[model samples]
Target: MNNKTAIVTGASAGIGKATAIYLHKQGYKVFAGARRIDHMQDLVQQGIEAHALDVTSPESNQAFVDFVLANSNSIDVIVNSAGFSMQGALEDVAPKDAKSQFDVNVFGLMNITQLVLPTMRAQHSGKIVNISSIGGQMYSPLAGWHYASKHALEAVSDTLRMEVKRFGIDVIIIEPSGTKTEWAGIAMKTLLEQTPKDSAYRDIVEAYADGSFDGFSDTPEQIGELIYKAINAPKPKTRYQPSFSAKMMVIAARKLSYKAFDRRLFKQFRAMISK
Candidate 1:
C-alpha cells in the first residue's frame, strides 16, 4: 500500500465518504473532514482518519489541514466534495438563504482549497479535484441559486487550473449529472420551504419535488470511483463528466442556441407542473 495521503472534504456521507473509503481501500492514507464526526465511525474503524470540519469556518479548515500535515507529512491529493443544493427562484429566494448557499457551495469550497494550495505548490506535485455538477453548465426552472453557485464554482475551478499549472499541481473538475445523494432531496426540501404556495413559481417547485423529471442518476459509489480514478491518473483531464449521459447533456447544452434551449426547458417545466 502506498503512503501517499489524501484529504476528502464532506466525508461523513455521500460522495465525500464514498471517495475517502475507496481511496483508503486502494492504498492511500485518507483523512476525511465533515461536520458530523459521529457519522464517520466506519472510516475510523477502517484506518481512515475522520475529523470534524465546518467548512465555512477558516479556523476549522486550517485545523483540519494542520492535522493532516502533522500525521502524513505530505498531502498528495485533495478532493473538494463538500457541497449542497439550495433551490429557489431568483426573485423568491431570501437574501440570507442565497448568501448561505454561496457560503457552502462556492466560498466555503474556496476556504478549504486555499488551505491546501501552499502544501500542494510546495510539493510541486499534487492533484486538486473540485466536485462541480451539471448545474454548472445547464439551467433549469427554479434552481437559480444552486445553478448560480455551481456556475461560479466552474469559473473558480477554471481560474485555479490556469494559475496552478505552473506549480505541477493539476486542477480537475468533476461534473456529475444526476447522482443518488442527499443533494436532490435537500434541494427539494428547500424549494418547499422557500417558495410560497401563492407564488407563481409554486406549481413548478411542486413539480420538481415530485420527481417529475427523468434522467440517469449514478450511485455515490460510482462517482467515488471516478474521483479515485482522477487521483491515480498520471495526467488527468481538465474536466470529467462522469454520470451516465452527463457528457451528452453538457455537449448539447453548449451546442444549442439560447432560444432553442429555453424553448425545450420551458416545455419540460410546463409539462411537469401540468400534471
Candidate 2:
C-alpha cells in the first residue's frame, strides 16, 4: 500500500483515464469511477480499481466514497473529472438537458466533494482538483449551456478553496483549452441531433460537426501530467491552465473587454460558418 489513495471520476476515457494511469505510475493507489463499466476494463487491467459511478446520484457518490474508505483510511486526493457538454443553440436546448449538464458538472461534483469532506477533514490534508474547461472563461457560439456549467464550476471551486483553506485541504481547478479527445465529436453530434434542424444557427452547427472548428494538439496525457503536478506541489495554485493556447485565451479574456472578446469570437465563427 502506498498509503496514498486517490479517486478519479470520469475514468472511462480521455483525461480522466490518463490521470488515473499517471497517478498509479507515480505510486499512488488509484481508485477510478465512471458510468461505463465496459469502458473501464483498460483501467482495471492497469491495476487501478474501477467502480461504477454516477456523479449526479447522492447514493452513488456515497457508495463510491464508502468503498474507498473500507479499503483505505486516507483519501489523499480526488479529481472531479466527470463532466458533460451538449452543444446547441440556447433557445433550442432542452431545459432538462441544461439542468442535467449542471447536475453532473457542478452539483454532482459537489456531491462527491461533500461526501469526502469528513474523511479529508479528519486527515487534515487532502487535495481536490476540478477539471474545468477554458470554455468556462471564454465562450463560443452554440455552446452556451456547456460554458455555463463550467462557469458555475469555477465559481464553486473559488468559494470552496476559501472555505477549505483552514482545513489544510486544497482545491484546484484545471482549465483545458482543446485536447485530442472524443469530447468535441460528442458535443458536435449533440448539437446537430438536439437542436432544431431548421434553426438559422444550423450553419455554424454543421461547421462544428464537419470539423472546421479550431482544434488543438493538446492530449489527455498532457492534462494528466498537469494534474499530477498540481497534486504533488507543496503549495498548489488555485488554477492551472497547462496548454499554451489555454493560457493565451485566459489572458485575452482578462485583458480584453467583454465586447472586444465577443467581437473577435463573432468574427471567427462568422468566417467559419460562411465558408
Give per-residue lDDT, candidate 1, residue 121.
Answer: 88
Best lDDT among the predictions, by candidate number: 2
Q: Stretches of candidate 1 above 4 Å error? A: 212-216
User: How well is each residue in 6-38 modelled by candidate 1, as lDDT tens digits?
Assistant: 999999988899999999999999999999999
lDDT per residue for candidate 2 within 146-252, as digits (tens), equals 99999999999999999998999999999998888888777777778887778987788887677644667789999999999998899999899987878999998
How many backbone clashes does every candidate have? 0, 0
C-alpha-based local distance difference test score of model 1: 0.87
Give residue 269's error in model 2 in angstroms: 0.8
In candidate 1, how many clashes are counted? 0
Global lDDT of each model? 0.87, 0.90
